[model samples]
Target: MKLHTPKTLPYIPVAPGALPILGHFAKMKNNQVAFLEETQKKLGPLFWLNAGFGQWTVVVTGEAAHTVMKNKETRSDVMGGEGDRITGHITTDTVSIKDGAPHRRIRGAIQSPFTPKGLTVSEIGALLEETAEKRTSGWKENTKLEILHETSVYALDIIFRMLGVADLDLPLWRKTYNDFVGPWTMIPFNFPGSPRWRSLKARDWMDKEFQKMIDQARATGDTKTMLGAIVHGTDEEGQGLEPKELFANLRILGLAGHETTAATVAWMFIHMGATPELWEEIREEAVAADSPPTSPKDMERFPKIEALFREVLRLYPVINVLTPRRVEEPIEIYGVKIPKDTSVSASLLSLSRDANLYPNPETLSLERWTKQAHRPKPSEAVQFGGGPHFCLGYHLAVFEGVVYTTIAARRLASLGLQPVLQGEIPKPTYMPLTRPPAEAKILLKPNYKA
Candidate 1:
């Protein structure tokens, strides 16, 4: 493999502070976004900052972001090296950190479960109904609830069942998974028996469980479900995936399928709750459609509802920062040549909020999407990311989003439910790192019955 060498680019300097050894570690340890924004204000979009030691991080936005995310030459090297420091905390051999042919093979193996052709439409509809029923039971009249945790549980349960991990230990898995993966976003250290340590343990447990599942499936001679497919799948050489690779890929698909979708669903409720008029409009639109609440085809036709979702992702993307990319070859970005081995990131938070791409970017407008809805192709929104590394489970995420939103909107419309926002939803403190607040609450009141 040809390695690109580092070349000096026009330097956009961040604020000069911190001791030589500490760098900006203190500020970053406290609040990453505040640190980034402070630097951006001081240094501009292409600024460089010292993360620690001699390590430097280049933060890019707007067109620069579009370039970084789509730059095939850069490869997803950061995910390979450092991502394991995070993802490995949850599960090992995750596809996110795998490269080249290995990545392709793992993703291909699991693709069937999420694709439209994979599951029968009737099966999907039934799953959605089961999920909605499970979710709606917790919602009370004029109640205040945190949607993220609820949606996460619903999504996890659905994914777990779909993957055929029905009898696995739930509480132990949840605690271990969260403990290991969650902290990695905030800090990279892994002390023994710590959350990271426990995460490792959980991962090992999952690995054994996955192997047992595969073994049982092999014994039964079934390749119908996702777990069975992975176990029974063969490469061009006609060899099945090794135990480690199978476990890793399964963990990656399972966790990625749930976490990001749950976060986006949380953001959806927060957005809808904050905007009463838009919420009511969506409610009315869903009620007017009068189709089965969980039908994907009918959900696809609800432009306003779709627009509302698009706008929410625009304002508050779930994965705020694109995982780091390493330059594989020399590339010019905004007239500066970035050499190989340079660590770079695209801020989806900054890109989605760009005023040029999104006029009056701070204000939420559902119609903005509706007016441009006729355009053929994906929107500029990088919430699902772009290029080869784009989310494999994109359709599944959208399916859940549509189903959950449709159910909420229809219920609210029928009872004329109005959500009373208490205060501003908390911004992510760790840039793209943190999850929705555990205590964040929204109150709902039913007014006019449809």
Candidate 2:
């Protein structure tokens, strides 16, 4: 494959804090958000920062960020060579990361479960409410819990059930999956029992397990679960998922489907806990009250609940940076040429915080979304990357968040309760996905009925 384009156009401005082989590593590791924010203030939207080992990371802010995300010449299929190498190319064919025709085919074949028809099924809605109720069922005064950890359990349960894999060992599944995804494995080493070695081993084990599910579904013609849908569904051209494609995509889909939603819900808890009065207002709008959602249409029935999730997603996007996009051939954005095989990404956080896109960007206001009765198209969704590669699971994620929040709020309201968060407001994790800090805790406080 061609690795570079002819140097016919002037290069994008390069940020200047290189320190030999270390590059910008010192400034970026711990203080990335502050570093990027300050750089964007001075560098104006788009610039390249050296990331050592001959790599240049393209960082774009504001409108140019959206341009890169939507540009057809830019490919989201590649992150870096090492991201896929350790897991035997586990994500090489994932629908969310593939480009062009392959992406279209896999996305079409596997998206049955995320569509309105798929989610509108009465059982699916009931399942979400049941799961939400399960998560909030045991909370009591003085309860000590990490919000992120709690939401993660809820999200994983939902995605696994949807995939018909709930019978598997979920805690073990997440741990193994985490091993495969941990950043430390990016070291490119594969010694036995090392993180990279364990990641590869986990992928192999997970693949065998998924293949068995696929085999059973195809034999029985099972069509109830999301896994079954992918097995039976076809693309517009009547193409079906190849085995490796199915395995790879299922793995990424499970991770993407649950983890991001979990992180977003954790933020929802933090915000809602801080504002007890808002919970009363939100609970009043939850027509379901003490029960789970009754039907697929119930997804849209709770306006305040939906807006609460929307505002939380906007203020604290779980995926701050869209996964790396690889430039294909030559592409120009804001008059700067990005050559073939160049890796870049857009900052969802920056775009979400842009004053032009969101007024009072730092403040939380349900009015920003509720007044407009906003349901954003994927192409314009700021928190979820906008464009062809926009998150395919947006509806499912939102449904899960809305259902959980509504149930939790309504359940608390029924008991004359509100969550009073303990400890200082938690800060975002220093990781790429901005989950609420694991130590942040919440406890019950009394508030009158909805």
Candidate 3:
């Protein structure tokens, strides 16, 4: 499969600035979003880089990315593994690591709760509001809040509740859950009082909790929560997940679903600070509606706010690069020939920032989507991702945003979000995922309910 490129066909080119051993790792670490954008103009979309050692990462953009998403020659197992480092959970058949029929089976079995006709939006909405209230109860006049930390817990609470944790256990569950997943980037050395040690302990706590949820659902024949969906839902062939598959996938849902939604909402809050007028826009979403959205079904009532959120995703995408896909067979795309056994990933940032796909791509304008004629092709924001492996929680994420902002708008009628430093908003960090600065602060004040 390593045949030399035909004289007629060009091999994929390497992006500039590959420092000896570090390759493009150093440059990407500094600012990957900018690096990809700048490189796209100079290198022409698709390029390869050595992250380190002999490992090669192929970066695809535009048409190439769309092709990769829909192609069978690529598989997702190249990125995530059977044992997840981030979650510290291991499962041989987790959907993210499996492909072909097994992947389909696992994905199908768990997908019902997220599907349009199956999810109970009202219940989820009620839970979301309850969680939001507790998380934001600290918000008072001139209160300084770190958007990322708040949104992370807010999103985590929603996920846990959906998986059947009782409201009373939410506070402790959240703390344990955070400790469980927080060691992904830390140095890996197992010792007492270490992050890894805490994570392992957290994992043990999660295992017991998940097993209880599974047992209760199995015993009661209940299908109300996501845990039940995995236990009872069937695939196309009418097969359900095995106990191992069910538990493994259930453990992964929090890690998989929480981050994207949290990062997106956090970015939205940053926008709320930069453009205080948007608060009225958010308020109007709830006001103009016949009634407030008590369920995901009511998201349609808030098109203006929906458009605003879509634009935020485009300008500030939560996914900088889709999980890298490994090429399984030789293929040619976009006039470039890709060899087998190579690591390739689609760049969501490239597609989002493409001027051809979006006019004035850098600017945030709702009309880009709200206006029928101005909407770009492949309309839904690609930030959630594309292809067969597109985000499983895409629908839930969208509805959650609509539900959250509407509730916030109505509750904090006088609330205003202003930069804590009172100047131009800083650029978001873009590695692992795109998110607002951890140190970024906002002043919330005079939010007397109307």
Q: Write the per-residue lDDT of candidate 1 for residues 214-270, one digit (tens) a residue.
A: 789889987777667667776554656667777767776656777777777777787
All predictions: root-mean-square deviation over Cα? 3.9, 3.1, 3.9
Q: How well does each candidate superpose onto the true structure, as a TM-score?
A: 0.84, 0.89, 0.87
TM-score of 1: 0.84
Q: Candidate 1, which segments miss by more than 4 Å at Cα?
A: 1-12, 15-38, 49-55, 81-92, 119-122, 167-172, 184-192, 233-240, 291-298, 373-379, 413-416, 431-435, 448-450
* Residue range with the least summed lDDT across 10 consecutive positions in model 2: 1-10
User: Between 1 and 2, whose lDDT is larger?
Assistant: 2
Candidates in order have lDDT scores of 0.65, 0.73, 0.71
> Considering lDDT, which of the candidate structures 1 and 3 is the better prediction for this target?
3
How high a TM-score does candidate 2 get?
A: 0.89
> In order, how many clashes per candidate?
0, 0, 0
Worst lDDT run of 10 residues, candidate 1, spans 1-10
Candidate order, lDDT descending: 2, 3, 1
- Candidate 3 runs further than 4 Å off: 1-11, 16-26, 50-55, 82-92, 183-198, 373-379, 414-422, 446-450
TM-score between model 3 and native = 0.87
Candidate 1: how many backbone clashes?
Answer: 0
